[model samples]
Structures are given as structure tokens and as C-alpha cells.
Target: KGCTWRTVSVDKIVTRDCHSKVFGDIVQATQPPACLDACGSQKTNTSSSCWVDCFYKAAAGPDSGKPGGKVAGMSFAELTAAWEHPFLPEDQGGCPPVKPKPPWFAHTTSVEQKM
Candidate 1:
């Protein structure tokens, strides 16, 4: 059971990473490449809502400067769905609720120590 749970967690991480990479690629192709780094730096700006928000604005915002309201062959709605899919509620056909760590859990550097 524990192994299965761990596998699900790993799968979620991999899926999130893949989605992020795809979003970043589309942002890079449509906007200035340096803008990607700018989004990273904007982490301090609470209003910006992190790199994802910045990238989303750049790729799909009204002033995005892309013709035909598309990025990398995906419509704005399609792109948003793809980028935000992993975070949607499970009943809405998204990932399950993340399991919280147990109170007794702790990392051990040596096998001699109890977990």
C-alpha cells in the first residue's frame, strides 16, 4: 500500500513537470526567451502569482502579440486547460488529494536509524 502511494506521488510530480515544460516551451517560442527568466525573477512579486502566471499572461493575454489567438497550435483555452489540469479537483476529473505526511515521519541519513 505504501509503495503504491509513493508511486502515485512520483507520477504526480512527473506529470506536473511535463506540463510545466510544455507551458515553458510555448512561452519561449511566443515571447522573448529572456522573458522566461524574467518570470522566474518575478517570484518576489506576489501580484504576479509566480512564473506560471507570468507565462500564462505572456502566452495568452490579450496583448500577447500573437496572431490568431493561438500559441504553438493550441488555443488559449486549450493551453490553460493543459497547464492547470494537474491542480484541478479530483471529482472534477483531476488528480487525487495529496496525502499528508504522517506525524512520525522523518528523514534518516543512515540505515541504522529508525525511520
Candidate 2:
């Protein structure tokens, strides 16, 4: 009753070769390889020193290191607007207000993960 749920991110998974030993009968996946969207590159790009150490500091091309300031010459107001997009009114592009559901529910589903 007191089980803890943990999310496994696909980024950390390194795909292993499937053999007959591991799988009894392996059938070709119904969907195309591209459509499967299976995890590929898990490389994490470092942007920690992206602004300070790069030519951006000199040419100032990447001037503002803050988020949403990617455009070469975006004003602070523009940056702020970009950052606060999620908080906009529902009439705008913001997410619709969420209605809380009751604790009691008749329908239920189970999630099973096989490694």
C-alpha cells in the first residue's frame, strides 16, 4: 500500500543486443523503425560554460545567457514574455485550467515495465 513510484528515463538506457536466449520468439515490430522513436543518442551537451568561454562573450552573439534570450538581440521584456508564456491566460496559448478529480474512482489501469 505504501509503494513508491519511480520514473525511469529513456535517456539513461543503453540498448542491448536481443538474442534468442533473452527472447523466446522475436517478431518484427509492427511500426517502422523511425516511428518507434526508440532512444538513440543519450549524449548530454554541456552549456554550462557555453556563454562565458565561447566567442559569444567577445562578439556578444550569445550575450544573454539567461533562458529565452537565444535570439541574438532580444530585449529583457521579450525574454520575460518568452519565459512567462506558460502562465498566460487560457484564452491565450496557456494550458487550460485543471479540474481536480475525486479520490474515489471505479475505473483503474495498471502499468507494468519489463526489463
Candidate 3:
């Protein structure tokens, strides 16, 4: 017996239109990089423009100029050095603040007390 495979796509479907209730499990099933889990999302203006600018800046700073960037030229030693250096703001000290514990029967002496 012969076998054949066919590809199919739905034109109108998109992430925005996909309801959480319908695709919540599917969305949750996705496994992002471990680093993403460790590092929460950061806000940025002009996302696409920032990506291009970031690539350029990382190449050799602003003076490197437009179309002057080379991504592959970077060596592993340089990359490793950057990875070891702190990426977070100096004020944060590279660590998120500790969250206070929730009130519970054992932990809570008075839930009624308004802080």
C-alpha cells in the first residue's frame, strides 16, 4: 500500500482570536526556554526597532554605524564574559525582591486587622 501526507492550514486563525478556554491547555503546554522562566518578561518600547538596534549596538557600540554590524564575528570568549556579567539594573542588584508570605491559619494571627 502507498501512503501520502498532506498539509493543511486555516487562514483566519490567529493567536489573538484563539480563546484561552479553547486553547488554554495548548498555550500552557508550550515549553519556553528555561532562562525565560527564570527571567520574567521585560517591557520595551518599539519592540521590532529595538531588536535591530540591539543587534547593531552589541556589535561594537553606536559608532559601529548602520549595516556595519556583524553577528557571527563575536567569539565565544566575549559571549561568555557578557553572560557572566550582571544584566539587571544596578539598583536591582540582579535579583528580584523577596515576596512576603501570604496569610494562613498558622501564619495569620488576625486576618481582620487592616494593615
What TM value does model 1 have?
Answer: 0.31
Per-model CA lDDT versus the true structure: 0.54, 0.32, 0.36
- Model 1, 1-115: lDDT tens digits are 5554333443343254444555465544565556546657674343465555556656566345446554334476767766666556656545554555554635535666636
Clashes of each: 0, 0, 0
**Model 3 per-residue lDDT tens digits across residues 1-115:** 6998774732222232222222222222232334223333421222345433443344344445647544442355754444332323335322222344453775655757755
Sorted by lDDT (best first), the order is 1, 3, 2
With candidate 1 superimposed using the best TM-score fit, by how many Å does residue 22's alpha carbon deviate from the native? 2.5
Model 1 alpha-carbon drift over 4 Å, by segment: 1-14, 39-50, 62-74, 77-115
- Estimate the TM-score for candidate 2: 0.25
Clashing pairs in 2: none
Q: Which candidate is the best by lDDT?
A: 1
Model 3 TM-score on a 0 to 1 scale = 0.23
Candidate 1, poorest ten consecutive residues by summed lDDT: 5-14
**Regions of model 3 farther than 4 Å from truth:** 1-46, 53-71, 87-115
Residue 11 Cα positional deviation in candidate 1, in Å, after optimal superposition: 15
- lDDT, model 1, position 7: 38
